[model samples]
Target: MKKEFRSGCPISSALDVIGDKWSLLIIRDMLVKHKKTFKEISDSDEKIAPSILSARLKLLESYKLIFKTKVPDNKKENIYLLTEKGIRLTPIIIEFSLWGNSNMREFNEIDDIEGLNSDKTLIIQTVQDNYNSMLLNFQ
Candidate 1:
């Protein structure tokens, strides 16, 4: 059977792929923190299980949000990096972060709201300035 979207709205289409709580967070980690390895993603504060992390990575790859590339020096592990389509989500993630920070004050103490706000803008601009810049730069 073929999968279907709930509606024709662009937002709906996007939500179909990334509406889940974990998927967006996975993308954020890859796009912002440059975390490529399964260990890195699994070890996040969310403490996503290895099995779930694997599934999310596969789903993201299927949607073309991310791509797997062989490590230049190490053939053992493949690095996951965001595609242009995925990088486009930086702003959305930033907005989500901002909203969460504002509404969920009891969650955690944000060191600098101003800095986070500024970083959000900067991150969005950086992604826009160079799409390829979103790719993993380190091992």
Candidate 2:
């Protein structure tokens, strides 16, 4: 039998996969910084444990939010790529980052909120449009 969603709300369903703090941070690292490898992800300041990183990657893959492929030049290493479903999350992540930047004084010192917010709307729209185009290509 197929698994069921927790609810009919789209946001809730999205949260089911990415609501966790670590999961979103991982996605942020991927989308914002383009960090793909396990070592790169684990080395983030968040200090996610190796075991947890492995588990989260598996879970994200299971949810079809990410897919793993052998690195082009390194057969021994795998690179994680976001699926269309995952790419659709770009706006949500950006918004959260913007919100945090606005609310957290310390975060402001580290993040370039003026620059980020200046292009915030455009960035979200571009991501959505590009992701839609990618989905069409997949189809």
Candidate 3:
């Protein structure tokens, strides 16, 4: 589906796809937290409403950020996995984490910045590698 955008600018076009309040968090849940199913995602710490979560999942799928499929053992249960496009958001997620860690510390107690000083490329690569490795057995 051709997505309607508010403007032709690259940032605006990108936001047109993932600017919603819930979309990035959903991607973070899948990409970082490794959430796979509707139930698993819904049961996350964010406590996203079922209706909103359903809509966000469909929107992400329509944008080609994630694909839904069922594992062989449970054809009735659907699991969502990131596409290459979605995996590309890893750096953004990492950046957001660092930004939050440095700027939003008053709101959150997670001050573990041990890896923040590490080579950023290495951090992003590690996440991508782990995600790809996990998908090796995904049918």
Q: Candidate 3, which segments miss by more than 4 Å at Cα? A: 1-3, 111-114
Extract clashing residue pairs from model 1.
none
Best model per lDDT: 3
Q: Put down candidate 3 lDDT per residue, 4-93, tens digits, no spaces.
A: 789989999989988876888898888877889999899987799999999889989998999999976889899999999999999988
lDDT of 2 by residue, 27-46 (tens): 87877667778999999998
* True-vs-predicted CA distance for residue 92, candidate 2, Å: 0.5
**Which segments of candidate 2 are over 4 A away from where they belong?**
1-5, 106-110, 125-139
Candidate 1 local Cα displacement, residue 12, angstroms: 1.8
Prediction 1 global C-alpha lDDT: 0.78
* Rank list by TM-score: 3, 1, 2
Candidates 2 and 3 compared: the better one by TM-score is 3
For every model in order, what is the number of clashing pairs? 0, 0, 0
TM-score of each: 0.82, 0.79, 0.91
- lDDT measured at residue 31 in model 1 versus the true structure, 0 to 100: 71
Over the stretch 92-125, how does candidate 1's per-residue lDDT look in tens digits? 9878878887877787775454456566678578
